[model samples]
Target: MSDRNPGMELDLEWVSRVRVNTQAVLKRAQQIQGRKLVKKQWEAAWLLRAVTCIDLTTLAGDDTPSNVHRLCLKATQPVRYDLLKELDMHDKGITTAAVCVYPSRVADAVKFLKAANSSLAVASVATGFPAGQTPLETRLEEVRLAVQDGAREIDIVINRTLALSAQWEALYQEIRQCREACGDAHMKTILAVGELGPFTTVYKASLVAMMAGSDFIKTSTGKETTNATYPVAVVMARAIRDYFLRTGHKVGFKPAGGIRTAKDSLVWLTLMKEELGDEWAEPHLFRLGASTLLADIERQIYHHVTGRYAAYQELPLA
Candidate 1:
């Protein structure tokens, strides 16, 4: 042992290695296919840390009254409704940040969600959803209806046709209108990254939406065939992180669609942590728009906390 304390030497060595590894991971990520977009996925791993909730947005299609009622009861029937709650009581995992639902079903979502936790937000889909091809007027109306119905967050898909067409002006106007329609509600502009031409287009669209006042930039609606990818998310995250660095305003990110496993969530979380740091970890800043992903995370947690595999039926569902 040198003059320095052995413990001090170990601490310094560990810190140095952590710095080196973090830098290497980030640099390697940047060189990857969607390197520019992987920031959030990596950052989320460490930022918010642990498991995050994913709203399976399209799980209930064409929200008719009966369907809405059923979903409402299912989402907010109380954890006490869960048999597992009988034995131990505490805030289980992370509380779901929002109850995502269709615009027409916002009111029903609001009713049950409020009963569960008043602060928990109600998010609604709008602006032509998966296609995002509706006329601007129709899209605005969609947003209006959702807000009026009590949705505090609105997710609108970008008009990819215009984006791919390189009609930045048209795309900018559409997002601006959608943002305006949101009024006080949080506006998340979905780039539909997979179908939006290229990662470069994703970056430009993200900038345009952020300029037009998007509170968050989402990767997909979880309805698209290609949904979200690590590369696409990397591009979007870099844009937001860089924007914050230059403008002093932090924006949120949501990588929706096709993300369904604890490992998948971990990949995004790792991206977020490595790219954006800890500030973006909370539900407010980072969210995985997944419907079936949470249960898997719960299962993993159960296994870790207790030494046995958690049975499927025994686990609670949102």
Candidate 2:
């Protein structure tokens, strides 16, 4: 689990008064993605930083112990050894921040990491992930079960119905219960921004999750029709900034789903740098919930070092 924030109590008045400027957010998103373009060595460095912040994830119905073990091994050494040697990063002990899997696979991930004598954290999506339509008690029990199975991070999906209905108190109480069930594990609240309607709702949901003691506010669960857009990210990042300013606590931001390319990772890194300053760019504060993204990053890094693009067969399966 990442560091805990010990979030403040729910303030319905503050949440109700929160507002977002859609035009301003869209303009900022456009400028951020178009203006800054790092090339060559600087781009490679930024990609490397992004690699460290990735929560290498494998959440599928077909997930098994064998596949989860492979993912753990890949998480231990994300980039190839020869490539790292060429870049002089071989001795840096580069690895993904954590391995995110479904709640049922938490034990498998833990066992694999332990057998390898590695310290990689295992993150499990609990509390009826993606849709979060299950009963509250059942959801909380799911969180407890995942933690009992050795998961250090619990990714819980918020009840979008409550947020959409503007039931701030209910949403806050539900998330608080889930956080309590997490025990010592870090709780990442997925707002499922794609289904949360406008940017205003996204901003408000971000605040509500942070106020309810979420260690991280994630954008999506990778099951929505659309996920992790730049404008939504800007709103959520600013909300995190606002929360930090008012309460003296820094909440983390995660942009998951549809983030597949190395360039996409660079854009998110730039967003964190420009919106919340450089402190949010670190792995402890930022995480990219992605599966296939690592392969593209490895390909880019290989090209950066060897001046030759690597074929798909050359990179390890993510």
TM of each candidate vs. truth: 0.78, 0.98
Compared with the true structure, what per-residue lDDT tens digits does model 1 show for residues 1-318? 001100100122221221123354345555543433333334323212334344434346666655655444444422222333432334454355666787877887777656655456778888988788778899899999999989888988888898788676677777877877888888888888878755667777777777667888899877678888776776778778766765677788899888777667767766777679875666668878877776666665555445577887887554
Residue 142 lDDT (model 1): 92
State how far residue 25 of model 1 sits from its true place (Å). Answer: 12
lDDT of 2 at 231: 93
Angstrom error of the Cα, residue 61, model 2: value is 0.7
- What TM-score quantifies how close candidate 1 is to the native fold? 0.78
- For candidate 2, write residues 1-318 as lDDT tens digits: 345789888888888897888899999999999976799889988898999999999999999999999999999999999988988889998999999999999999999999999999999999888799999999999999999999988999999999999898899999999999999999889999999898889889999999999999999999999899999999999999999999988899899999999999999999999999998999889999999999999999999999999999988887
> Which candidate number maximizes lDDT?
2
Off by over 4 Å in 2: 1-3
